[model samples]
Target chain A: MTGRTIVITSGKGGVGKTTTTANIGTGLAMRGHQVVVIDTDIGLRNLDVVMGLENRIVYDLVDIIEGKCKMHQGMIRDKNKLELFLIPAAQTRDKNCINPEQMKELCAKLEREFDYVLIDCPAGIEQGFKNAIAAAQEAILVTTPEVSAIRDADRVIGLLESEGLHRPRLIINRIRPGMVKRGDMMDKDDITELLAIDILGMVPADDRLIIATNQGVPVIYDKRAPSGLAFSRIAARIDGEDIPLMDLGPKNGIMDKVKEIMGINRGAYSNA
Target chain B: MRDLIRWVVTRKENTKNAARNRLQMALMRDRMDLSPDIINALKIDLLAVMSQYLVVGDEFQEFGIRRLDESVFLVSNIRVKELPRANAN
Candidate 1:
């Protein structure tokens, strides 16, 4: 099958790029698609731990690329999902170990096998980031509502465009609605206006996301988690499904409950 | 009562507005690959060139670099009163 390779990237660190990669990879797998997530972060690999497949990684991406092991041997099956797999990065190797040509060739091979190949890009605009994006046909840029993250994201967008990867979809993660309402944090409009990219999804700041990461289980499995629900919607959109974006405003009033029950709560219940 | 007292006592503007303003300026500079001073100089030079053909007004309705889709444009909306006289032989 000719699968699509998409790189999940955020130019800044700790903006949920790895977590987004894990969740979206799992979300696609849950939809019965054969998916493989490759962590191109090299020495700073964390996608395996986030996916809870760290123990299952007997062979890694470097091993397969170096001809030390077969492709299937390097792929580790998920603990719970049958269709999902992961190719963990080499813990001891640096980004200089692999080049863009190798990554392009590797992704071409992976695309022939899986239905979706998701690459978790490294944090900077260095060799690791270039290698991560070299193989992908599309990109999903992750950023927070903060100024620094947005600035870095804009720079990455320019770099991606210069490399012929245009119109990268955006995912704004870890947004705090209270802070936004208080005029302390940037809102979706403010960011979208600056970035000028189509928004793939917006994940609210959820405590359960951190807990799920700590437990080595993706937050997408948590039905009650808002961030989980957002990722699921993003996955559906990526899988060619038309789903409305979720509204993450305050839900404390009885009027909102009544409107939600009547199926008219300002598009908040559209996906629900 | 505490909220009201603090609201009256504090003169702080919303920090998000400040962030939005700064980001707008920064992104404009980045997309054009030029500093604000250079952009200002370029704008003046462009206006001077345009005034050679037409009677350009002193004020501009809109004049700035704008990004739309995949392109960055040095967009301007200057008031043109009339065209200059043509040379007669």
Candidate 2:
């Protein structure tokens, strides 16, 4: 069967698009499906580093598009044994290097070979964003619970609707259940109501994600990490598995009370 | 006299509620681009002319024009106090 193309995007920056692309690709590959992640950031490529394949990138998306190399030559295999690959974007070139048509053609070719192709889209609703969405059959919009992020996500949803991309699934990233309970930040219901979209999953704000990214490791390798498990659940959903979302809230515990007393602000509440 | 006072209070409250509702609907419609600026401008001009005829008091409620679908509404409450004969002249 042909692969499904899924573009992971958020109109606002720093909402974990690249991280999600990497982890979901890893998660899907772990399930025995061949997966490839394409970083569409072009001039600002970071997915390679996030996936720990930066040094292995001999050729990039631009090189493949420009006919300097075959498509397979650009795909970097993961450090683990899973059948995951990375097509890093060219850092030297800008977004203008590849247009929507070219991206669509490339994804179409990749889909014939792989079971899943995840595109890590750039920030903003400009040409780069358009290029990423043109090739995908499914879209996963990532956003935090903050007002600004939610507002941008709403705008992005409107744009997607205009482009005929209907019913795109939502991934509310960096949620803090404690903050939602305290009424200090917008909750899942608040975001869902405002955006009026079906939610695929919610990922809590986990610090280990930073360490994992820095170490050139996809967080999905660690089953114990909250963020990693969240991505795995998202992957399962993508693969037609019915997995429940993770309970990110503070359960009954003395440590939870200590965290509240220490004033460890939760997710969106930290800024509010 | 008590009936007259109650009637006046009820009228005032009803007017205020109507004005608030109109403003909210108009604003929402305007945001959705269902109401054009031509109608909004016309509503503003009408409001300005009406203000000159009414003895609108300090407690007068002002509501911003809001758009609701295809309709434009003037959402505000003006206290139309009766002017004395000398003041009217």
Candidate 3:
């Protein structure tokens, strides 16, 4: 089947690009679609560790590109039983080890076999960034609700537009509802206005995400986690569903108590 | 005393408007890359020449000169009631 190549990118580091790629890949695979995630960060590879497939890498992207190994030999299957796979980057090689043409050729080959090919782009607006975007058919920009992150996201959006990638959707990560309610941090609305782009999803700052990542398990498998549900909804949206965004604030009254009584968690009740 | 109070308030408003107008005109001229000093000198020279032709009262109200782009404009808000009409002869 023909596949869509979606690149998960953010200009600022530590804003959850790797986490997003892992979760979205897991969510899409859980929906029974064949998904392959490629880590484009040549030197500083972390997607393998995040996906818990670090020990399984015999050959990497550089090996496949350098004709040392077959493309299928470099692809590592997920520990779970879904049709998910990952092509880990070579930790020893630098960004110059592969170029955009090589990446585009690799993705074009993978697209024919998988339903979704998600690329985990490296931070910065350098050569690594250009290589990642060159092969992407769709782009998802991840950003935190901070001024610096938003500014960098805007700059990234400008660069993407210059490359003829228009109207890239945004994903607001690490939003703390408490801080937003206290007016200490900018909310999603503020970020959306400043960035002026469509929002694919909003992932809350859930502590369980850290625990799952540390345990080499994606949070999307933890159905009880808010961030997990958010990722699932994002995957569903990508599958062409019009699912409404989940309200990630803490519960505060009879409605929450009713949800507690009914055993309803995660987007349990509607405000309207 | 009431008339004096009204005059004071109105005079303050007029001064504020004049200041705002001058600032706007100066900013426009600056953005258009014109020399303000040259424009001011030209306005003074034009006023002097106009005064020799007729009694030019209230220099601030009688005329205003501003530079717009590469051109200059002269605006006059004179009291026509005080001046003799062309058919007065």
Estimate candidate 1's RMSD in Å.
6.2
- Separate clash counts for every candidate: 0, 7, 0
Candidate 1 segments exceeding 4 Å error: A252-272, B1-12, B35-89
Docking class of 2: incorrect
DockQ: the better of candidates 1 and 3: 1
TM-score to native of every candidate shown: 0.81, 0.75, 0.73
Highest lDDT model number: 1
Computed on C-alphas against the true complex, the DockQ of each candidate is 0.61, 0.04, 0.03
lDDT of 3 at A214: 99
Clashing pairs in 2: B26-B66, B26-B67, B27-B66, B27-B67, B29-B67, B29-B68, B30-B67
Q: Against the true structure, whose TM-score is highest?
A: 1
Q: Candidate 2 lDDT, tens digit per residue, A104-142?
A: 899999999999999999999998999999998888999
Residue B51, candidate 2: C-alpha displacement in angstroms: 19
Worst 10 residues of 2 chain B by lDDT: B14-23
Model 1 whole-model lDDT (C-alpha atoms): 0.88
Q: Write model 1 residue lDDT over A35-91, tens digit each, in one string.
A: 999999999899999988888879999999999999999999999899999999999
In terms of lDDT, model 3 sits at: 0.82
Error at B9, model 3, angstroms: 36
Candidate 2 residue-wise lDDT, B1-89, digit = tens = 99999997775553423433443443344345534577566556766776677655544366555455556655676666755466566
User: Candidates' lDDT values, in order?
Assistant: 0.88, 0.80, 0.82
Q: Which structure is stronger by TM-score: 1 or 3? A: 1
* Native-to-model Cα distance after best TM-score fit, residue A85 in candidate 1, in Å: 0.7
